[model samples]
Target: MELKKLLEQQSAEAWEKYIPSLSIDCVIFSFYENALHVLTVNMKDQNLWGLPGGYVQKDENVDDAAMRILKDRTGTENIYLQQFYTFGNLKRSESAFEAYDDSIWNKQRFVSIGYYALAEHSQVKLRIDQYSNAVEWKLIETLPEFMMDHRAIFDKALLTLREQLNNHPIGYNLLPEKFTMPELQKLYEAILGKKLNRGNFYRKILRYDILIKLDESRKGGAHKAPDLYSFDLTKYNEALKEGLKGNW
Candidate 1:
């Protein structure tokens, strides 16, 4: 009973001194027309684009706060969100807070954690808040002048996604449930920002043995329709554990 009382006392003490300053930033990524896209919110007063982020509430977990921020900013939920890294550099810029008339930056130092979500472009319905002038999708290659160190944060998230693609099934997050072989190949080319030999790419993907060939093919008139395929998550998980090589 004495040990239980001590445990209760420590828990109470810990709660009393906790100051909630943790924030979460979501780097919502999507693919469209052979290009990677990132969601950006335009600040009305600063005329700068920034990632959708929010402070974690005292009652909510870090992952919960990230999902809330993504839903509130992009009207997206039930999407795949992965915690990539945390940015706690003391010298990180808080210039965006200075842009406001209120002394928002004078509060306690904030240590923001970054999370990324991948979803189809057609699934997101962006809703800009009062403080934000607009919310729109910006091509990864052509990001606007942003505020704070958001550009660096975004770059790190993209790098993590690329690294994950080598060993994990990242293509499912970027493409539709049923996609053509050429479409799948192009998606990788876009993410890697390079051209891949069509024949070799096909061979490599086939060797993985994680794709389910569907009977349907792309309906077109110009040329032969490419066969449709879908990822087998069951097989993918097993193969992913073995680590995939992207030599092709």
Candidate 2:
């Protein structure tokens, strides 16, 4: 009873008594129209664009902060958010403060933890904050002038995603519920930034046996109809644990 009474009494003043200097930045990536897309927001007083990011609240966990940031900026939740890295170089602090206004500088110094997330583009409804002028999707190849080291952070996230593509079945996140093999192949090519052998790539993915063919095809009439396939999450999870280790 004493501990509970103390906890109730101290809860209101806990934040004012102690504050941690930590922040979360999310590199939200999606695949659209055969290209990779990244979510960016422009600050109200600055001309630069940057990834959706925010400082962690006093009572929030790091992972919860990341999810809250995503929801605040893009109206997205419950997506795959993974911590890719922690950028703690001394220079990073200077750059981040420089990107902001004098009012923000009044706060204590902070080091940011970076997280990258993958979600379907259609699932998000962006909500611009008071400090942000607008939020929009930009092609990964043609990014605008970003604040601080966000560009570097984005590059690292993409590199991490590409490295794990072969071992994991994340490429499915880039596709619709039912998609053609060519569309799936194009997503891999976009991320890998290389042209893959068509026949060889198809055979390699088929060997996983994680895709189920559906009785559907393209609605147009210009070219041959390709078979549609949906990812089998159960088998894909099993294959991910086994790792993709066949001849390519």
Candidate 3:
């Protein structure tokens, strides 16, 4: 009853229970230290990598199936997940995942729905499934060769994420419960893909009036400690409803 065998049997069963055309792909983004990264996995003997994804089951809701896949891959649940785009181009899966030994996978074409979520990097412990030989976070800007149209999917997901930041505070998922102002600004700079003026960024963010500055100071090294703060979720939600403008 090895996981590999179980997964192989499940792959056979997938032909019967899973949709022939529809699938789900997750772009889990995490802000680690000062850089942004995406979760990627490579199958056995395959040099290419792609996002965490799976097929939709016949009786299951697509959203539920997506959540299950995310939990199985990242060991994290309850994080907010948003469905962003559906990739329906013909031959989207052509020649993808070809290194796998499973014959069933080669028998069909798949159109995948792309979903995305952000999580605190420190909170996640990756769980590789039977199909993947290894898993790691890769820099979005310098990703390796991807299978099929996953490169296009990643690009769309990044664009969608940047758009979400402009209208929502969902980016908070990428940080710890308490953070310094510089930490928050660093996140914006990473997502917006540009540096911002320190004075301007601080003033714009402070105008939201949703952060609770704590008396504690950020400590790790000998650098001068900065005051720590946490966002008031109630006020944050209200501000999100009003939609945050890109002043930075």
Would you estimate the TM-scores of all the predictions?
Answer: 0.85, 0.86, 0.90
Sorted on lDDT, highest at the top, how do the candidates line up? 3, 1, 2
- Write down the lDDT that model 3 would get: 0.81
- Candidate 1 global lDDT: 0.78
Q: RMSD in angstroms, all models? A: 9.1, 7.4, 3.0
What is candidate 1's TM-score against the reference? 0.85
- Evaluate all candidate structures by whole-model CA lDDT and list the values in order: 0.78, 0.77, 0.81
Off by over 4 Å in 2: 1-19, 96-108, 246-248
Q: How many backbone clashes does candidate 2 have?
A: 0
Instruction: Give the lowest summed-lDDT range of ten residues in model 3.
Output: 98-107
> Which one wins on lDDT?
3
* Model 3 ranges with Cα > 4 A deviation: 1-11, 97-103, 246-248
- Tens digits of per-residue lDDT for model 2, 39-132: 9988665556998887676677888888988888778786778888887665654554453343343133557799988888889898877657
Q: What's the number of clashes in each of the models?
A: 0, 0, 0
lDDT tens digits, residues 145-189, model 3?
888788899889888888888566665688788988888888888
Candidate 1 segments whose C-alpha is farther than 4 A from its true place: 1-19, 99-108, 246-248
